[model samples]
Target chain A: MMMEKLTVYADRMSQPSRAVLLFCRLNAIDFEEIKVDISKRQHLSSEFREVNPLQKVPAIVHGNFNLSESHAIIVYLNSAFPGIAEHWRAKINSAMDWHHSNLRQGTVSYVINTVLGPATGRPLNPNAAAEAEKVLISSLSNLEDIWLNGDGRFLLGGSQPSIADLSMVCELMQLEVLDEKDRSRILSPYKKVLQWIEDTRAATNPHFEEVHNILYRAKKKFEQQRSRVAETGTEPSNKIGGHSKM
Target chain B: MMMEKLTVYADRMSQPSRAVLLFCRLNAIDFEEIKVDISKRQHLSSEFREVNPLQKVPAIVHGNFNLSESHAIIVYLNSAFPGIAEHWRAKINSAMDWHHSNLRQGTVSYVINTVLGPATGRPLNPNAAAEAEKVLISSLSNLEDIWLNGDGRFLLGGSQPSIADLSMVCELMQLEVLDEKDRSRILSPYKKVLQWIEDTRAATNPHFEEVHNILYRAKKKFEQQRSRVAETGTEPSNKIGGHSKM
Candidate 1:
């Protein structure tokens, strides 16, 4: 069977894009990965909008058809590939649905308001990060108690990691940039969740680390800036992270 | 064939619960409809948490298995019943994913803060709503220009309605609680969207109208109160919407 050609527009900086990119690489799916450079605001350009009128990252163009939203793109891929386990179909669907407004919201929005917004040149919104902490704790507790309590090593108790796990673990992994005290305050309470993250990472291996390299670099730069500010008497300029247009 | 019994925990006031309940009622799915009244804060109670720890409505119990999230529950039903149309599987899934932080967020939060909060005596956050309108406008424009552009009456250009139709239209119908001028200002610009709502309502028929009766009455009482205030020139002291604890 001839597999349909797919062109993926993605950025490593975003959580969902990392999940979609890692999935393709882990499965050895043939495709072109075009870096959208969200920090550069490439997603707002007219050409990208032609492919995805919503102008969001992690969109895919297949033949004449175009689809946006990372979860949607992954679901489309599941059918196109025909190799995903039958048992995973319904459970994975449910997980993605739950992930959308829960883990995705709790993790991504929390970090964006707290660390990313301030670290980047964008103005940080007050109290959102504080509110987000409550949501994150509640969400991670559910992930540990409800989703992971099943017999399998991954969510839905499956022996292998589903796309849902990849999607969620990627969202949680963004906390790596935050200083240890803050990161642990949020993540350390959930015992099963930490184990699940490691298991998911080991399962995805080289591709997992490969896709996350850019994020790791971003964290290092953030740390260096914090240290530099400590050495200097003056505050870091407002334009410190101007590249993060998103 | 013998069928397993199912139980659905829901609240009529919440948009997604209406979607899930209507799907069951329309398809003749055998299930117990348990109304966890949000006004009473029944969903937050410990008993309900045993069913769905996250404490949100539109959860379900099938034997010992439990699941929350309206989108997840409906998708699970599509497979468990196997009576849903084949064409709906992919498109409906995609629509639900796109809906989470987009249409659902834009419509529900905007109304909650702008209209429902004030009417209900809940503290309304100004910026959250001001921000939500921007998102709502962007989402509606896409629904008009892209999703509704198809030949079919509903999203995905389908001849008959899908669960996605049930979910999204339920969200837009919440605007019925707002006054005519406000509602018209937000809704009137999108001709196709207005038509799509009517088409969806017609397709779903009596059940759609029947399910939305609570919202209808809420709107009527709101109008009556406004009229009373006009005649007497005093604010209504009674909190009419106290039951809508959400």
Candidate 2:
């Protein structure tokens, strides 16, 4: 029962891309990983436009059918492969709705401004990052109160991880780059959510770490830059010039 | 085979709220509609927060179950009800994903900036509106190039309208307040999408018009304000001053 090899256009640094990549690997859904380096602006090139004219990455091309948006791609994959055993369909649907403006907004944009900005020459806008942090804290609160209510290890209170869990946790992990005080100040309040992050990583195993390697690297670079600024009072600019490294 | 009565929290003027209202009515899903007027800041009240802590309109509470986000609410209803003939589930899923950033971002944000701002004392920012229009036009172009490529009358090429049609067309209709020239310039080229808008309206008929009645009224007011401003060169400040009407 071999599935057709699906072609996934992704950049590991992208949060949703990691979600899609991890989903495929975890589900044993065979896919050819096409590295679309967003840092190189590869996603915006004309060739990538053929796959996703939206010019965003984490898209998929299955035969002639092209799909973009990590959520839709995951939904398509869930149905395309029979019996993935995600029993919390109702809760999963709710979580997706919650994810877009909540988790997706809080982590993704915050990281782009605070963590990824310096690397891309858009020096971190602290005001924007602060607003994003507020959003993330509120989002985590919502997650704790609603999605992760039960004692289950996942958002859906299921024994197994659902698409919602994968999509959300992937974005949340990007907070790793922030100074410990800032990250923990927002995240530490949500004990259950933190535990679930660990649980999700555990359940997804090697693939989770595989997809998130780029984020981990970025986090290290960000911390190093932060400490350098702290020590020498020197500008953190010019450390990672050019978009190719993003 | 009567189902438990559903309770929907919505505001007529909110685009997604209209989508949810239209969805329920179109599907003949009987529900009690609870008015949560954003203009009055009713949604932000502690009481309303009990229902949806986000305090955004268009949440539903069915029995003990609560849900938020118009897209997810509709998707859940589609599954909950038996034999609802809105086929093209796959295409519908794709459209929802596409609708969020593309249609929702462009149309909804433009309407918010251009149309709603003045009524609330925020005044129109032409630059922002122009930027939003470009986004809307680009979004429409993408729709024409991709979703409307087939011979289908509706988005999924189905005879019956799906939630995607309902949600997207509702958002698109918010463009009515734009200057006729501006609106036409952006929308006129896309004959297929225009026809689909017509098709969705026809399919969702009475309910569509019923739900969008507030929008049409708002459009009328906008036009009157523009004409009055043109004639008298007076400030368009005194029209509707308070939250009760919004």
Candidate 3:
């Protein structure tokens, strides 16, 4: 059977988008990556809306069948494609579902409210950031104590990294944009989780680092902006200012 | 090979729990319903923690393998058992994932903050309730305009109801506990959504009603409480009052 070519619509800066992209590259799945520049508000355009009515990255067009939501897309890809292992599906599904309201929700809320909001013209929301930090800390503890209880490096004790690992590590990567001290304070306690993140990166490298370049670049720019504020003895502007666009 | 009996830990009051129970009953999958009453805080008990360390309702023990997250549980059940249609898997997976951040998040927040918070001794937050309403309305619009755009009933236009339909409709049913005028005002705008909800309920039949009886009973109690407040010219107590426990 001739399979329809897979085209992924993603913004590399978005965590789930990076997961999908990294998954495809790691599996050697033949695909096209159509960059959906979320930082530029391109995802909300009508053109992209035709692909995903939710107006979110990353969505996928597998021939005529269009699918959105990262977990769903990856699960479908795993089932539809060759070479990926099947044994990981159920546990992977559990981890991904838990991710939404737990890690993904907290990390996304924390990053956007505390930092990225300014880049996008949404002002800092200290109350929301604080609440998100609490949720993130609790979720990290759960990840370490519950999910990573086993000796294996990857989630659910899989020797090979699963889609769940990719998705979750991508979420944690959002913390990179935080102030170094703040990021350390939040993540330093989760020793096992940090080890698992490194393990996942090692397992799916090159592509993992490749997809995350956007985030790393943004992180550097954010740090530079913060240091400038410190040197100038001025509060950072509500916006990212004219120069440093994410 | 003989399969181990499935045991589901659920509270009927929870939207996702009802979805899981209704799915099992509709599919005639042999299972034991072990009620983990959230209102009574049984889900938080150390015993329940053995079933699901996350301490959330709607966990399942299928033989030795325990799974939490209703979407994962239902999808695993659909696969591990017979009688479920296979074609619905990808679309159903997409809908369930989309539900987490959109419909499920918004509806749960709106209900908890606006109504159910007090039942559990958590005071209502008018700000959160108002914010949740905005999200709920936007989600409903997306449901009407995007998901239910097809001629056939249910999400993604399947003739038979999918897990997605059951989960989403169960979430909407939370509104039943709100004041009648508020419920109508919130729901009436999306004519197609209301019809789709009915279609889902009809497709699931006697089981839907059987499981939703808990919600229906709670609805009646909330209404009576409201009427008493109106007649006596007293602000409805922040609590649901001692006599009416959900």
**What would the TM-scores of all predictions be?**
0.91, 0.86, 0.94
User: Candidate 3 residues B1-246, lDDT tens each?
Assistant: 127989999998999899999989988888999999877779889999998988998999998989988988988898899767764777778888889988888898898897788655678788888888998999999999988987788788787788888889999998998878889999999999999988888888899899999888998887777788779965455453345444
Interface RMSD of each: 1.8, 2.2, 1.0
After superposition on all C-alphas, the RMSD of every candidate to the true structure, in Å, is: 3.5, 4.0, 3.1
Task: Say which prediction, candidate 1 or candidate 3, comes out ahead on lDDT.
Answer: 3
Off by over 4 Å in 3: A1-3, A233-246, B1-3, B233-246
Chain B alone: TM-score in each candidate? 0.92, 0.91, 0.93
Residue by residue across B187-222, what tens digits does model 1's lDDT show? 899998899999999988899999999999988987
Model 1, global lDDT: 0.83
Error of 2 at B123 (Å): 5.7
The fnat scores of all predictions, in order, read 0.51, 0.36, 0.68
Top candidate (lDDT): 3
TM-score of predicted model 1?
0.91
Residue ranges of candidate 1 with Cα displaced over 4 Å: A233-246, B118-121, B227-246
Q: What is the alpha-carbon lDDT for the whole of candidate 2? A: 0.80
For candidate 2, the per-residue lDDT at A225 reads 83
CA lDDT of each prediction against the hidden true structure: 0.83, 0.80, 0.87
Give candidate 2 regions above 4 Å deviation: A45-47, A123-134, A179-182, A225-246, B123-134, B156-160, B178-182, B226-246
- Rank candidates, lDDT, best first: 3, 1, 2
In the order shown, the chain A TM-scores of the predictions are: 0.92, 0.91, 0.93
TM-score of chain A of 2: 0.91
Deviation in Å, model 2, residue B188 alpha carbon:
3.9
